[model samples]
Target: MFVENLGIVLALTGAVLSALLAGIGSAIGVSRAGKAAAGVCTDQPEQFAKVLILQLLPGTQGIYGLLVAFIALSRIGLLGGGEIAALTISEGILYLLACLPMAFVGYFSAVAQGNTSVASMAIVVKQPTQAGKAMIFPAMVETYAILALLISILVVNAI
Candidate 1:
């Protein structure tokens, strides 16, 4: 059965990794940003909303990871109970390879965005009036996450 069902197993592995790796990254990223926000809010409680928004920026990758995993799972019949035979070993490897981009990129981008968010929070501390401008710095890091999400989605769907 292992040989016969290898494809479905691999496909499921991909789906799980997409969610797992990205979620881990987001957790770390959010934790970093949250710690920074908490430090800033100690003195400037009024800036809660601004810092909260900034802290959430890195979290999109986790959500995107879930989306891609769901799509891949659904495509591979894990969601609808379609059929294991529909996917060959080659297709399973393809699915696994396709998911790698989201898994790795999401992980790195989230950590980077989190660090960026922390730095951005410093702007909130110094120039409350420029809080809006401060967001731009972390927001820029989101582009890579978006690109990874789009590519993963496109490739998983195509496969």
Candidate 2:
């Protein structure tokens, strides 16, 4: 009984930690992007649409993390039956560890991407048609976030 309760605790901890990290990361990203957009708009008002889209790109990581957390919770039967199973210490640790990388990567990458997007918006101010090209750097930065999400998902599944 104690072991099962421990498993439930570990699983809930992992899910909550993962969600918090992702949320914080996305929050940082969105904040940076919004600031950049505001800065850009102050000068070139016409680039609002492009800048807004760019700002929104980094915000997706939080959503992905939330989804993964839901999956993890569902897998552990926390939402329905509330029944818990015993997990090996290693397995529980792995689940927690897996979420770390994604959280770290998502946070930094989003901030970097926000900076990149800001630069891109500056470029757009001069060459509106080149906005697409300017987005390449931010897109590249986003790849790591996707990778982190993949790793988190796989780890959760393994647990």
Q: Tell me the whole-model lDDT of each prediction, alpha carbons only.
A: 0.90, 0.77
Candidate 2 residues 89-143, lDDT tens each? 6666666676666667766777777777777777777888998887786788888
Best by lDDT: 1
* Top candidate (TM-score): 1
RMSD of 2: 2.1
TM-score of each predicted structure versus truth: 0.96, 0.86
Candidate 1 lowest-lDDT run of ten: 77-86
Instruction: State the RMSD for candidate 1.
Output: 1.1
* Stretches of model 2 off by over 4 angstroms after superposition: 1-4
